[model samples]
Target: MSHEIELKLALPHRALPALRRHPLVSAAQKLGNAVTLDNTYFDTPALQLKARKVALRIRRQGRRQLQTVKCAAVSSGGLSQRPEWEQDYTGAFDFGAIDQPEAAQLLARHHDALVPVFTTRFRRETRVYSPREDLRILMMIDTGEVSLHTPDGVERSAPICELELELEAGQPLDLIELAETLASDLPLMPADLSKAERGYRLFLGTPSTAVRAEPSAIDATQNAVDAFRTLAFSCVRQWQANAAGALEHTDPDSIAADFIHQLRVSQRRLRALLKLFAPALPATFVADWSVRLRENANRFGDARDLDVFHAELFAPVAPEGLADEASFSALASTVRRAREEARAHACHNLDMATQGRLLLGLTADLHRLTIDSLIQAADLRTFARLRLDRLRKRTRRLAAAAETLEPTRLHALRIGFKQLRYAVEFFAPLFPARAVRRYLEAVVVVQDTLGFLQDVDAAQQRLAAWVAADARLAPAAAFVLGWHAARYARLRRRALRESTPLLSGRKPW
Candidate 1:
């Protein structure tokens, strides 16, 4: 079996012209051949192969055919390293060359059940660049559509436009350097979803949905930088997966709303994580990405706020006479229009040339990172505990002064609580499950309480702004603001009271 290490990027068709003219592609070691590739992905009727994370595909290029099998791979920040087996196709399926025992045995047992599920027909333009004698990167620009064919002769397809950078041979940093250089000019965002995965989702007719945090695979023996990469990449995957879904959906009320909310949550998680681990990371790197993530969060802020307004605030309280049904409907319509416009603006901003470059640069930076000497030799548990303890002390101080704190200070305290909460979750897998749960339960109570108060504050501000912008909305906005004013104060008090348990709870780790 051979290992495939590559970085994949997804870009818009509009980027193709600029990318082709970029120095990295135009002045390559060799301008390689172009070909039309027709690929068909195969799976059992019950998707047995998919359950095992095994992918089987046959590709036809001109008169030649190649069959390939890819097993479960560790993928992060669009970079993947997987055990893959490939060989010439002799008009039939072949598992003889697959050395991975699990994959070979499974295919041998279920070979008869395999059937084509989806196909991708794309034209690829290839280029090879050699930055040094020992390093070579194969770059390809692919344009086409992934299609699923029905037994009734119907076909459904989604457009596919991407740039792939595969490490032909060399150190991983070489690949990072090449990608960073290319991203300096072209719009390229590191893509987490593989074409095969996309095809399977299309074939299965699965709607995109919010993705939760997967447990970090950090171990006690790992370095601090390694642990951070694992955690940060987890956040990146969550953000990218949702961003793809949000950008793909054209309808405002479709899966895009859930996707946008999840994307924002992922961004917050990443930002909090960076802040928690900033002491160990390169300062400049942390600072740059911090600003980028915050900007991204702001881009989605208006739309997400509007989403909460419609789902959580207005819909539930409409019967309390804030507005008549017709008037409420009119207001809802106005909100919906504003939301669609906001989403569109956010999407356009995300699709801009600069955003893609930023994403690619971020990916390259992550790949290029190495543990500093101070952190490399340190124990992960000790490192994690030190950060957690510092956060806990800060949180306790904030909670102790909660009632007397100004609004801005209270907000800062809430943010501290949030970071601590995220840090616990990020490292939860390394500690005892029950102990972690007990501590988290108290943290959640405090965290959610603070979140509610923040929501009320935000809603009041949003209502005031809306009414200020349009005098016609003044009456409805006034009623909404008045309805929440007393409740906000009561909730704030409760939130302060709830902080006692968290401030006093013992550390689980």
Candidate 2:
């Protein structure tokens, strides 16, 4: 058994020429001529192996056949590490080489029921990248398709074009640095999906959904620095997943708005985590990444704002009379055009190369992060309690100021509530689950109310400009604002009222 450590990157087919022209690729030694590999993955009808997160495949290269068994991969930021066993396959199935007891037993029990589930055929161009004596990486460029043969005699397939960087003798950071170098000019995006994973998705016809923030796994037994690293890595995963989704679907008109929204959420969460864990992290790391993540997330802000304006604000407003009908129709047209333009502009700037570089750089830097001696020994639960207290106090101050109903002040208070909510969510795992859930439920309500208020304020600014540009839009804008006037006032009062108990009550942490 051998542990495989590799970084996978998805390359646009159009970028193949540029990748070939890259200096690093040109300088690397070609292992041999490109070869074709045909691989068949096997599983029982019940998919017992897949259920256990194991993969069994047989590969045919020329006249030679080899069987490989891979355990579940631990992946993040496009890098994966997994244990695999490989041996010559003369004819029948073999689980003898698999040293993992659970895997071996599972495979042996279902050996007779195993059947071909999916196949991948790709031409792989392998090169040896040896920049120094102690460093070596295998750069393999693959382009082909993964196919599934259904019982009904139907074949489903998806195209595959990727670059895999297998760390042969160097640190994982070296592989990422090399990828960053290549991505500087190529349309390379770090891909967390393996061919086997892709094949399974195709076989199962799984629809892509927006990735949300996962629950915090931080425990009190760990040190503060380790807990922060764990949380930070989860944020990176969310960011990378959404960025990949946004980049994959290039048509702005048909793109899922949730992708852009969730990408921003991930960035905001990371920024919040940086503040929450600042004491345990290096000052420079926190400061630099906070700025970078904020700038990147802001690129999609216009699109998200327009989406909310169109969906939540405009869509709910109905024409009450003939005059409203005509004016509202005109306003709707303008809003649609602006929304499309914003989406297009955001999509245009969602450059794969830029995003890939940012992700890889962050991942590498995160791996290199070191804990100060003083921070390395601090109790995680104690640190979490202190941070949560600070956030709660700050939010309480903001809530008090928000009572004046000043738009700017209210917006600031909303941001404060959001940060506080995120901090609580991050530290919730360290406290009693019931108390944390109760507190979080209240935080979300206030945050949601404040968020709606902020949206109304933003919409007013945009609508005012539109109204100024066209007198016809003035009545429509008035009607829209008037429609939400009562709710906005009520929510404002409710926000202040609901936040008092949350701020004054027994804390979760």
Candidate 3:
């Protein structure tokens, strides 16, 4: 059995020419001949092997056939480590060379039922780079498609364009550094999805859905930097998972708006985590990444704003009469067109070259972060407590000043609440789950109320923009403006009432 350590990157097909001529790739030693790999993945009807997190595949290169079994892998920031056992694939199934007894047993039980599930045929160009003494890396550029044959004889395929950096020798950190340097000039994004995973997803016909933050288990004994890495990685995974969905669909009109929303939320969560750990982390690094994240997520802004207008402001209120209905219909039609335009703008920016680079840069930054003295000396519990108290104090002070606060100030309070909530969620395992839940519940009340107020303000702006853009939308926008304005006082009251618990709630930390 041999362990495989590699970093994967997803690139746009259009960027292939630039990548080929890039200094990094051009400087690397060309290793042997390029090979065309035809790989067939097998699994039982019930997908028992998939359930076990095992992959069985047979690859044909020229006249030689190789059978390989790969165990479950640990992935973070597009880097993966897994154990693989491979041997000559004769005609029949080969389990004798399988190193893991449990995997071997499981394969043998369902060996007869195993069938070809999917295939990936790609031409790979190989290059080797010696980053430094005693450290060598193999760079494989693969371009092709992953296809699955359904029982009904339908074929479904998704294009594949990727770069694999496999460590031939030396430390994994060295690999990360090399990747970061290469990506500094190239449009590259770290891809967390493995081809096998993508193939299985295609075979299963799984549709993408909105993903939320999962709980991060931080050991009390862990240092601050490691805990931050754990939280950062979790947030990165959520962001990338949603990003994959966004990239898979080409038609912006048909794409789920939640994909963009969830991606933004994930990016926001990472930003919040950075703020919470700013003192312990490199300040310059954190500041640079925050700006980059804002820039990247903001690319999807207009689409999201239009989506909110359609979903929240327009859909809820029905026209009272025919005149109102005509006006509303015109307004809706105009809004839909505007949404399509915005979606097009967003999609154009997110295609082949730009989509993955920001994400890859983010992943590379996280991988190369160095723990400062403060972080190394502090336990996660101590650091978390300090962070929570600071945010709580900031939140309360803002809530207290809410009476005379401007809309922007109120928005600031909402941001504070969001950060506090995310911090609580990130460090929930450090404290009791029940206590954390109570704290989160209180924070949610304040955050939701403020969020509604902010949304109303935004809706008003959207309505004004629509009315200004088209005279036909004037009456409909007026009706919406009147309807929404009347509720502002009520919304403010609710926000104030809900702000009580958050301002006065005992700190769980």
Candidate 4:
């Protein structure tokens, strides 16, 4: 991912499942024998800035197989903005105590919580015929001092804790039995005071923030939002990587087409993100920018979709005609003509000197725009209005250009159609997403009708050339050409009627 990544492990109070104690439930139970450790964590300057965490932790659990979970925290000291929020991400690592001494010591040094029970693992494993304790592993993430006390009797309930164990059906805690037992026998009870959590430390209650008389839900929505954005950024970055590799070689068609696909997906993320987070951001900011980016993106999308499909899909069907060969020369000829038309159109649409500049501008904008800024702008509504206007204007411009012949007008009209559809999509969400979905279907109808016709026209020309390259299929080539001409006319008529600009000014949303 191009964006920075931060991981934290947390068990929020709201996320806990409801608790019910059965007749077998023990007021005080024990984990027969298990592994235990005592540990603490700290924060450094760089780790604090990047992870928004000042402290780190590693906690160990289990006996025979020896499993350890690492946890980290961004203390309020490291967290500067939105004190109510904290970020967390988690993953698990296994330590092999059976064979490796290094793994044991490493666990001893880094692991903290449940250290007191480390010695119990041997006991738990030693029992030959007993059922395994349904132990659970969990972490509690508390932003404020959350009260676990019951309102009726003032008995404290466990708060801000996460427990993990693959439970059998209807059995929630083999581990809870152990926890309750340890609390009863030892001086430790569920910690009411809040402390920092880390890759290695255990904390409970209110974290660094002051405790509240009444607790509020942990607002990790911002963190969730950022994680999603980071993921989106990664998708776009893949295109950047592909586009870079394409630059290294000389196959313009393969390279340029892949780059365009990446561009299209990148634009899609922009579109979806704008819609998804519309509630959180300013009205039209994501929409307006979406329109602008779509303008450039559509030019590539139209040309490349056709070009790439033909290259990847049809090449297998007519490999011999690809160049000069003994292969099905007629089929190869047809494909070449189609490829040339689409490629020339995309390349010629922009001035030679400025091709990279226009493409880069769109990608750069996506990279630079911040999630916070997108929300603060004209907002989704106002932005959508502006985007629609821009798209409508562009569509009209292309409609005018379509007056010209074979390739030039076709090229211009392609650009117009892309921008117009995108505008409609931007507004589509304002109505029913289902209705917007229907509009996209109409778009496909137009493309299929027109696209089929264009395929025939170009195919006829290419097939004729293939016959010339290798005369063996001369008779078949002639038959195909005749079929293409008639089909081409049919498709053209369908396209012209379907894509009339009558709805261009309508309230698309």
Candidate 2 residues lying further than 4 Å off, grouped into runs, are 320-323
Candidate 4: count of backbone clashes, pairs at least 3 residues apart or interchain: 49
As for candidate 1, its clashing pairs are none
For every candidate in turn, the CA RMSD to the true structure comes to 2.5, 1.4, 2.4, 22.4
- Tens-digit per-residue lDDT, 1-509, candidate 3: 99999999887788899888999899989988888999999999999999999999999999999999999986765788999999999998989888789999999999999999999999999999885789899999999999998989999998889989999798787777777777767777778778998899889998767777777867898888788888888888888777777876779778778888888888899888889888878889889988888887898888888888778777777677634777888987887898999988877766534556666667667777887676677777877888888888888888877776467778888988898899889989999888889878878877877887788778777778778877788888888767667676777867767777766766677
lDDT of 2 by residue, 226-344 (tens): 88888888988898889888876789898789999999999999999999988888899999999999999989999999999988888898766634777888998999999899999
Candidate 4's displacement at residue 283, Å, is 22
Tens-digit per-residue lDDT, 248-359, candidate 1: 7755555367777888888899888888788888899899899999988888788888777767666666445546555455556677787788877767665534545655
Candidates arranged by lDDT, highest first: 2, 3, 1, 4
Off-target runs (Cα >4 Å) in candidate 3 are 96-102, 184-186, 322-326, 372-374, 404-406, 469-472, 485-487
List lDDT for all candidates, in order: 0.79, 0.89, 0.83, 0.40
On TM-score, the leading prediction is 2
lDDT of 4: 0.40
Better of 3 and 4 by TM-score: 3
Name the best candidate (by lDDT): 2
- Tell me how far candidate 3 lies from the true structure as C-alpha RMSD in angstroms: 2.4
Give lDDT: candidate 3, residue 178. Answer: 74
Candidate 1 off by > 4 Å: 29-32, 250-255, 319-334, 405-409, 469-472, 485-489
Task: State the TM-score for model 4.
Answer: 0.37
